[model samples]
Target: MVLKTAIFFVISIAAFAVMFTTMAPLTGFLSYHDVPRIVKDNNEETNWFALTESLLWDIFLVLLFIVQHSMMATPTWRGLIYNLGLVVVERSFYIAATAWALQYIMQSWLVIPDYPLWIIDTSQSTPWWWFFTLIHVMAWIIIYGATFTMDLPELLGLKQCLYRDTAWEFALICTICLTARFTNKGIQ
Candidate 1:
């Protein structure tokens, strides 16, 4: 029991690390991952077939992540984990799985042909760059702040595995960690 908890605690922490690492650019670290080409000025040379395939591939990646994320949260899934006597590490496993899904998407998501729907031209000398950077920094600060409002360690399975909690605490911990995820619990 101790070993399982210890291992999962490490796994969950690693998962969170990967999540932060990849999410920064995709959700927060834009255009950093390895792609031969990024958003070009225009995509007049795009091939229809190749573009279609890439778009479909991106859609599939997103859908697969959604399915895995949604499936794990269902009561039936929880019951299976409980029956398997894996409740102690369920949250950790879920976090790990979530990380895996995000990692896959982040690594595989195709950069579609650039349409440049709307171009915001803030030259290097302009303060708009700093303004936008400041806004992005502020946004991330608020996100992290909101995350701390909830028991992040417990949600990540650190406290749960480290300390013995009563049934009520366990049940609450089983719910997906809030912050933008929770309709009623987030900044709603």
Candidate 2:
């Protein structure tokens, strides 16, 4: 039992780290200057220190993931689908909530330069809105596919859906995406 717990914890951490390493840019952690400013002119250069910060942040995220994942065993396909639906709902909520918050921040702060907040301007061809929408749609599709094929454990009760391992992993990935939006630099 103890060993299972440890193994789960380690697996969760690894999962979180891998997710964060890729999703940071989608959240808004990077800026135009971090690479080449092709859109808004108020571009700021990338900070090298952010690399170190990202590493540390990933570490912390993984630790949290370990704790969360270790709480339950692997979920079956039905459970995974249920968890995926939950993720869709959760991501929808997050997208709406964060957009609202960004609007509030822009309104409240005077003399606010064109800086990347919760929203990031990736290119001149389209607004961040398009990119975010694309990402959300793609994520939903991937999650749905993963869930549809899962063969959930028979022991899992409907009421225990929230406690499934996949749900926690999905939630953690969303959180990591949120954090990465605010901290990532340009693609290295």
> Could you give candidate 2's per-residue lDDT for residues 1-188 as a string of tens digits?
45544443444444334443434443343222233433344466655465556556555555544544443323553366456544322322222333333334333333213333444544554656577667766765786467547742211122123234547567668878877877767333
Instruction: Show where candidate 1 strays beyond 4 Å.
Output: 1-46, 123-125, 165-188
C-alpha lDDT (0 to 100) for residue 120 of candidate 1: 54
Model 1 over residues 109-171: C-alpha lDDT tens digits? 776635433555445436776676677677778877898899988777666565644463655
Best model number under lDDT: 1
Residue 57 C-alpha lDDT in model 2: 58
Q: After superposition, how far is residue 11 of candidate 2 from its true place, in Å?
A: 25
Q: Rate the local accuracy (lDDT) of all candidates.
A: 0.69, 0.43
